[model samples]
Target: MNEPTLPTLHWTRRALLATGTAGALSLLLPPVAAAAPEEMDAAIREMFGNGTIREGRVSVKLPPIAENGNSVAIDISVESPMTEDNHVRRIGIFSPRNPIATIAEFHLGPAAGLAQVSTRVRLAGTQSLRVIAEMNDGSLWSGKASTYVTLAACVIG
Candidate 1:
């Protein structure tokens, strides 16, 4: 049996110093901040200008307690007919406590069959999740649900 030879390793002081400087710079940089209410409101208003967000018409389905914060199941359904005259235009998902409050935006057309969607998202912690549905007629509907996360993700202890 032949014995394997270990490869020789070379260390450069300049390379090590450059790597350490880059690491220190990263720590000094400002952390990514979460979306504020004003920003979120502006985004919503931009989507639905001068439109009121009424509840009841839209429904949000999520567990009261999330076992895993990495992948939380979410479902949103709007009470609307998938017709040429009346249909859902888009669906926006928001998490108040996430680094970016706006999680996802799904555009829908009449061919979608129904105004319903299901997906999984990462939650930073226990926070309120909001779903806004925009109709073809420029009407906005909203649904909200609170989720308690047992283990939060994307945050350092």
Candidate 2:
């Protein structure tokens, strides 16, 4: 005797659309072929596209030499008018040496008063800390500083 046939499910428009969107996003992600040192050119392009980026009005403060890479203090402040027309929108921190290039992102608005943020980050070793700020005027500014670390962190399989 033959077994009864199972029912087949058809793909719906919504399901196909969702799947296609997810597939498109997955294509933009870096491959899983082992993490390598991040290149500034690539990271910047991924973050801001081909927009013009300047190097002023932003400051990234880090210890010239960090005794421990596990917890390095980071301070970023942007000089913006902080008005309805001109304000610092957000800030992003990156470390090229880290396994994960993108470190952190902070959002701000005109109500923030001052475009300043302080946080801690992990570093792999001596590397440059890159900070990029987006303004309400659709402009981007960046700043970078080097920090030397003695003991490294985030080295896991």
Candidate 3:
């Protein structure tokens, strides 16, 4: 009777050791740090140019303590008269601690009749969020809110 032949294994001792060492080292290393405030500013500048970001005419509402960072609810509103001459052109939400500084953005026109937005965002950790509203008059307004997260999302290593 003939017996079936088995395929030969090709992993060498050196290759196995190298792979194991690399995985071990990777597990021991810490996750990369979150984006800094300077980085956030740079991102804002890159998106909106060197325009001054004035803090007012906008409101950021969120829970002071977020139990889960996965789906934290946020409310952003800009005090503006939704007229063709004066309205919110765009709204940008930014996070300094997230893997990416820019979280979300919304665009609106005078037809919308309101400069309010409500949505959910995933946070990497406890950090402050900045909401910037761009007006039709080429002005930028900002609002800030801070929250503590018990569980973090968007973790990177």
TM-score of each: 0.74, 0.73, 0.78
lDDT of 2 by residue, 1-157 (tens): 4653532323466678899999888778754222354465567667766789899989999999998888999999999989899999878887777767788888899998889999999888888888989998879999988888887775421
TM-score of 3: 0.78
**Which residue runs does candidate 1 get wrong by more than 4 Å?**
1-38
Give candidate 2 misplaced runs (Cα > 4 Å): 1-40, 155-157
The global C-alpha lDDT for each of the candidates, from Candidate 1 onward, is 0.81, 0.81, 0.86
Best by TM-score: 3
- Backbone collision count in every prediction? 0, 0, 0
Worst 10 residues of 2 by lDDT: 1-10
lDDT of 1 by residue, 1-157 (tens): 4543532322465677889999889768754445566666777676667677887678998899998888899989999888999999999988777766688999998998888899999888887788899889888888988899998767642
Candidates 1 and 2 compared by TM-score, better number: 1
**True lDDT of residue 19, candidate 3:** 97
Q: Superposing all C-alpha atoms, what RMSD in Å does each candidate have to the true structure?
A: 12.5, 10.7, 10.1
Ordered from best to worst TM-score, the candidate numbers read: 3, 1, 2
